[model samples]
Target: MNQVLTQKPHDMLAATLSNEMAAVNTLIQTRMASEHAPRIPEVTAHLVEAGGKRLRPMLTLATARLCGYSGDNHVKLAATVEFIHTATLLHDDVVDESGQRRGRPTANLLWDNKSSVLVGDYLFARSFQLMVETGSLRVLDILANASATIAEGEVLQMTAASDLATDEAIYLQVVRGKTAALFSAATQAGGVIAGAPETQVDALFAYGDALGVAFQIADDLLDYQGDSTATGKNVGDDFRERKLTLPVIKAVAQATAEERAFWMRTIEKGRQDEGDLNHALALMDKYDTLSATRRDAMEWVTKAQDALTALPNDPIRQMLHDLADYVVARLA
Candidate 1:
């Protein structure tokens, strides 16, 4: 009701997501606490309170609740999802050398990478404990595969950076591996715990994968299009890092000999000057890469909604459908 789902002033998708996420806040809190280690609470609380949309865990719980699941495992599953997400954030800061997150100085910036990495390890271990408590090997397998895929994706992103030869196919693989894998696992596990029919379970997985891919692509597009105050990151931070995103990748695919020389000198070599950013963006516009990337993102959102057609016509399902549209529509 408060419309706090997004930091964006006009974004309704984030608002819808916020409403669903608000329902799971209590579960997130109760499970973030630890009895055995006093340090666990302080470290975990510091990061949890740092603020996130809690989208992953919210999907887990919302999907489970939508399926008429009456069991309490949704609580643990949701918490487990958050822990995994937080762990990734912590490690991501270390890897990216990022000093800020959620518009605040990051954990690594505040306490140093050592603390961030160690605390992240603790959360990973704790998440495993929560999953084990569920006594569901099937759940374990899903999360375990996600963890491996996440690690692999991170490494792949690192390797892909500054590679002028990177193509759109590899870019999509990186997105799926790094971003969508966990989302799919989170939603799929929700249906699994609900013991939903196999068809519905598969649908949830497809729904999440498409939504996550669209979400990441939208975020990438926003880097070139969004207001700096709203996104909480500097415009073109990806460009600053010489990272190849969808727009840049698409632009590269169509670059002429002269345009390729500019990209190789700037994005690939990190030889940026003041006007170089505008020049890079000009190339993206020249090749219609921004529009193309946005089209791809919308297609994924459509696919995500199609996956949800199997869900019953309920308020919750409608909310998810609207949320998918909202994720990509923000850029428009």
Candidate 2:
């Protein structure tokens, strides 16, 4: 068998789109520079140059190309998508008080919270400028709504964190807002910029939404049972953070009266002790919530694959389909 054939779907997609991705990187570097405020570039470079997968922006580039876009505007949109993502990451690190990102000290940790916030604001302004340059009202509208939705989702997650009442429906809402909104916007804007038909645009939106949901759910699942090395965090990190992810939600929903008190003490009140993580995992195992969460992630994967049926039968499309499968392949 060819070695390339055995590579992961995203790695393959990255290789296939290497030239375009290089262009996106160049554009990102160009736009992230600062003429007046050197700290803007310094803060931005700390996070942007970090070795992230760049999966979100790549979605924009791949979707535009899959829709037969041959214009340079897609490049701008790809950079816009990345700027928005990085800005959110900077803000998120502040909110989460995270010390590390991509296995390095977070920008907020290296600099200060003030610099991260201001630099993130600068990036958001830059993203809007890039989108406006495209001169497409619909593209602007899509990205603008996504930006608002991202903020709203973060607020929702903050308010809902550790609340026992936070169920699967609320979880889905948060996921759509924080993760899927940008994803759908990235793909939908790509199709719109390419002047793809309405049906194809809708399909692209659906594909991105489902893929984002699947990706997030898989990430949540991995937080419980994944390898510390591969996942870049110790297992049960979510439990420690008091996050009511799907598995914990499922377990909470099925908790006995005694189990409810346990959740109330540890999750709602944040009085976790040394054995709390083990107890939480035991509860999830007792209710088989991990398997249930995996099932939910797989359903989104199926929805994503179904949505791709409406797209063009290009090689990029096949990679996208495989990408959906790869998101949850770890859980398998």
Candidate 3:
């Protein structure tokens, strides 16, 4: 299997998994509807139709097919993965007070916070219903635990967001809880549905976990370096938001007393003014925190690629391998 570094990784996966993805899409539409409330579908469609990459669900379909799964259950599982992801986005927008998502108005902004929160809950319930239809307790356990971990991670971030005391370890804990939990569960449940060997299933979980970490690190790094037109975000959005991501965490660890005061004034007290973003970038550059963050992201990418060696050597596996690299490649 030749590794493809030229193409978009998920696009390649989508081409290969087109049929399965269609089924997942149909299932998502069917399950997202509420007969009593037209408002439910309207709110759900606003976000669902917003053109976000369906990466999480695609991982489930890819892993299941890679493991030679032939059952229709993977379709249900893929939709379940999507529902969980959509639900999270709804709640996160409300929590983050985000006005925009994927370059469009967020559901909370379009409708209301109450609509966003309740629709998120509705999707969550739909997810469980879809998962239960699979009749695999192990699958249910993985997805259920992932849901809990994501909620816990969000809570942890709330406490750790502005605190300078947040170290890389705590940051990783939050990432694992909020992001990697679903990624791991998506791949793990896919393998479980295929009845793959225990080792392969564990490997799938590990791959998803590492990939999720790298994916998030790259996203945080982008907040500092990405083109606003391309990312649909201004540079240092996270800084203005006062979220203590890895680059800032690294910079804080190496901050001088004067630099510490700057971080405290801007990040801790939320008293940012003109030139603060530039100063934050300067300090991060002085400590080489962006490079340090990139290094950590690449390490996770390596971990993700290494995990793939445990699975069958095939086209899907190769695509997964490239997907790991492509995640961090955005930083370059």
**Which candidate tops lDDT?**
3
lDDT for 101 in candidate 2 is: 79
What Cα-based lDDT does every candidate model obtain? Answer: 0.83, 0.91, 0.92
What is the C-alpha RMSD, rounded to one decimal, of candidate 3? 1.3
Q: Residues 207-232, candidate 1, lDDT per residue (tens digit)? A: 99999999999999998888778888
Candidate 1 segments whose C-alpha is farther than 4 A from its true place: 1-40
Give the alpha carbon lDDT tens digit for every residue of 1-332 in model 2: 13324778888889988998999999999999998899998888888777689998889989999999999899899999999999999999999898877778899989999998999999999999999999999999999899888999999999997899999999999999879999999999989999999999999999999999999999999999998778777788888888899999999899999999999999999999999899999999999999999999999999999999999999999999999988888676
Q: Count clashing residue pairs in model 2.
A: 0
- Which pairs of residues have clashing backbones in candidate 2? none
| Runs off by more than 4 Å, candidate 3 | 1-5
The residue-level lDDT of candidate 2 at 177 comes to 84
Which tens-of-lDDT digit does each residue in 1-332 have in candidate 3?
23444678889999999999999999999999999989999998887888678999999999999999999899999999999999999999999998888888899988999999999999999999999999999999999889889999999999899999999999999999878999999999999999999999999999999999999999999999998877887789899999999999999999989999999999999999999999999999999999999999999999999999999999999889989988987777
Give me the overall lDDT of model 2: 0.91
Model 3 worst lDDT run, 10 consecutive residues: 1-10
Q: For this target, which candidate reaches the highest TM-score against the unseen true structure?
A: 3
* Candidate with better TM-score, 1 vs 2: 2
- Root mean square deviation (Cα) for candidate 1: 3.4
lDDT of 3 at 272: 97
Ranking by TM-score: 3, 2, 1
